[model samples]
Target: MPIPRIHEIMEADQRILNAFSPEKLHRLGQAIGLNDSTTVLDLACGKAEMLATWARDYGISGLGVDFSEVFVADARDRVRELGVADRITIEYGDARNFSPRQRFDVACCIGATWIGNGVEGTIELLRQSVTTQGLMLIGEPFWRKAPTAEESVEMGFSADEFSSSLHELVARFTACDLDVVEMFISSEDDWDRYVAPKWLTMRRWLEDNPHDPMFDEVRAELTNSQLSYTRYQRDMLGWGIFGLLER
Candidate 1:
């Protein structure tokens, strides 16, 4: 089966596809204590918002890799818009095949660990790209509470899919041989920002492309996504971008 590219529906205009508020995103950057000497390796970087923002705000340099042609193009344009083109490189390719071209001060798999199949594998991928003292940032979702057996099977997610709690999530990191240094957890408001705009984007696209072949598919995706989010994700899911180090 083909994978659904969620970001494709989420809209190209969006710089950050993750449930991160501008405040929270800035805080994530702050956790790194970004400086001019910093460099980053962002795998599965959707539109490279964090890297672009860091470049503009901290004068850091980095390479962002993602398989989405549209997203990679947008990321390039974003850095150009921020006048940091020289400091940022956006590559369009399969993140699973992406090897570290150079060592980085920070290597991130954020929000797209599925590229490496799961968190532990993704951490290993990031680990290969990071310098000795480099930070590894992984963005993952934890269950705020365990879903009942009934709720588990909804929206193609089983209760078993999530870490039982935050404690287990941290344990997963330790099992991967990484130290949990710091983290920036997303608030409901941040998730709201990430999701609400996509609704508007989908609605607008549907309005403009009523006769298009994808109308039905897009409509169904919009409906199902909205339903799944409101019914299960918002209340049951918690997300965090954790900073890690080799143990």
Candidate 2:
């Protein structure tokens, strides 16, 4: 399992500092069709920024579940800050086994769909929370083309494990009885926004706390990742946020 990095950086000002920007958030919201009456079940909702935005701007009511204690607490605080605590509820729990007591109008498992093992598994997991006609939103990665085995390895993916074609992704969703209603593909600029800032954050942290034991490790990893990312991911892989409805 991947370590929860968001939790380690959960501060009021830095809550989503390393994540996507407000423009990206707005685009995702538009892609997911968030509206005033939409009731969302946000699985793996880190800090609940999306949920809070939906509730505050769109007047959506929903529940958000995440395993990270820091994220959950921050989410709660954010809801209070937005004065929409009544519209959203956050819980500390794993998304894999979560089953809400009531159904929702929309079920979303964003970038952290690995909680259900994969995209298909995530859809099955979310079925428990979605109403019969509700939508399922999934955020996933796809390669722009078939990547070389060495390239896949460099990106932290097993050569055969994480490699998937766009056609196969669509086929998998179709096979699972989902109709693709909409999709928002992330551009290279989006990748730049998501990844480039981490280098700066890590560099700043390392410079400020050179005496820390983990400083070298953090610096090395960030440097390596920044270098490898341009070669392996920026030119090769693409990401998308997709919305599916029952077929």
What's model 2's overall lDDT? 0.78
Backbone clash pairs for candidate 2 read none
lDDT of 1 by residue, 1-247 (tens): 2235555865755878888876777777877798888999999898999999999988899999888888887899899999999999998888888877789999998888898788888887887899999999999989998888777766667887768889999999998888899988899998888887888888888899899877888898789889888998899899899999887
Candidate 2: residue 7 Cα off by (Å): 7.2
Off by over 4 Å in 2: 1-21, 31-33
Q: Quantify all predictions' global Cα lDDT against the true fold.
A: 0.86, 0.78
TM-scores for every predicted model: 0.95, 0.89
Question: For model 1, where is the 10-residue window of minimal lDDT?
Answer: 1-10
Task: Give the C-alpha miss distance for residue 158 in model 1, angstroms.
Answer: 2.1
